[model samples]
Target: MVEFAALTYGLLASVILSAAQRNSKMARPHPPLLLYLGYLLCGLSAGAALGLGYIILTRFIGH
Candidate 1:
């Protein structure tokens, strides 16, 4: 369940961040594919952090 939740959260984060990135650069024209990948990387990192935090919190609280 934790794994599933992590992936779902990661994907959601990626999409939302990507869209925001795209919109933010409308005046400067669209970015290249590599930039999008970078945004995805950022989102995945955030999700990993969130997942790890959740795990630690649950472990201590459930104890």
Candidate 2:
């Protein structure tokens, strides 16, 4: 379950980041490597945070 949630959130984050980049007014000819790394880091962090939260919630609810 945790793996599933993390994978889902990570993919979601990537999709959203890509969409935002596409819609930005100041579109760059090519995105910087740092920017791509930042997106990956953001998605990983978001997924980790959510997974932790889910674990805590399940424990709290005695599931």
Candidate 3:
């Protein structure tokens, strides 16, 4: 369950992040490495948050 939640949320976050980046009208381009790192961090954070929430919910519900 944790793995499922993590992967799902991580993928979702990455997709959204990429889409936002593509649609943004910035004067200067960001470095590729920086963008990659941002995506990585965002995905990991979102995954971890969802995974933790799932764990807590399960515990509270006594599943």
Candidate 4:
């Protein structure tokens, strides 16, 4: 479940980041490839944290 959540969040983050890049009107310089990778990594981390939190909450709540 954690792996699936991570992948889903990573894909969503990448898509949103790429779309933001495309839609921005500022004269910003092109970002490096690593920047996109970092974005995906951040999303995965977020998903992991969320999944863990859910697990902890469920355990305490007797779900």
Worst 10 residues of 4 by lDDT: 25-34
**TM-score list, all predictions:** 0.49, 0.47, 0.54, 0.47
Span of ten consecutive residues with least summed lDDT in model 1: 26-35
- In every candidate, how many clashes are there? 0, 0, 0, 0
lDDT for model 4, please: 0.74
lDDT of each: 0.75, 0.75, 0.75, 0.74
Report the lDDT tens digits of candidate 2 across residue range 1-63. Answer: 989987987777776668667757567554576468667778778987999899999999976
* Alpha-carbon runs more than 4 Å astray in model 3: 1-26
Candidate 3, pairs of clashing residues:
none
Across residues 9-60, which tens digit of lDDT does each residue of candidate 3 receive? 7777676667557757564576686578677777778987999899999999
Tell me the tens digit of each residue's lDDT in model 4 across 6-39: 6887787777677567646565654666468657
* Order of models, best TM-score first: 3, 1, 2, 4
C-alpha RMSD for every candidate: 8.1, 8.9, 8.9, 8.3
**TM-score for candidate 3:** 0.54
Q: What is the lDDT of residue 34 in candidate 1?
A: 49
